[model samples]
Target: MEKERSSLEEMLDAARKQFLEEDLTTLDFKIEELESRLAFSVTTEGGDVCAFCPTYCVA
Candidate 1:
C-alpha cells in the first residue's frame, strides 16, 4: 500500500509539473480573466455572486 501510494503521488507530481510547464500561461490568463469579470460584477452589481453557487448569491 505504501509503495502504491508513493508511486501514485510521484505520478501526480510529475503530471502537475508537466502541466505547469506546458499550460501554466494559459491557466494564468484564464484565472486573471475570471478575476476581472468577478471584480466587474461586484462593482457594477453591488453584490458578491458566483455562478457556481446559485443558492447563496448576494445580488
Candidate 2:
C-alpha cells in the first residue's frame, strides 16, 4: 500500500514547486514578502499526524 504524505510534506512539495516555477532574483528572492499565512499542515511537533485534523492551524 502507498503511504500517505503528511501535511508538512504536502506543503513542502507545493512550496518547492511554486519556488521552482517562480523566477524572482534566483536564490535571493527579489520579490519576497513576509506575511502571516494559515498553515493547514505543519511538521511533527508533539507527534506526527496520521490523519487530517480540524481546528489545527498555524499562522
Candidate 3:
C-alpha cells in the first residue's frame, strides 16, 4: 500500500507540473469541470491549487 501510494503521488506530481508548465487557462477550465463532476475540490494552500484529484484527504 505504501508503494502504491508513493507511485500515485509521483504520477500526480508529474501531471501537476505538466499542467502548470503548459496552457493554464484551458487546463484550469478542464480541472474545474472535473472537480464539478467529482464533487470534490482540489486542495489549495498559499494560493497554489493542486491540479489533480483530492486523494490526500484524511478521515
Q: Per-residue alpha-carbon lDDT of model 3 for 1-59, expressed as tens digits? A: 99999999999999999887787878888999987965554433334444453345432
* Highest TM-score model number: 1
lDDT of 1 by residue, 1-54 (tens): 999999999999999999887797888889999998877645344354565554
State the weakest 10-residue window (summed lDDT) of model 2. 31-40
Residue 43 lDDT, candidate 2, scale 0-100:
44
Each model's TM-score?
A: 0.40, 0.30, 0.38
Error of 2 at 52 (Å): 60
Check candidate 2 and list the clashing pairs: none
- Highest lDDT: which candidate? 1
Please list all clashing residue pairs in model 3, or write none if there are none: none
lDDT of each: 0.76, 0.51, 0.69
Local accuracy of candidate 2 as per-residue lDDT tens digits, 1-59: 12355777888999998988765445445323221121324444535452355544342
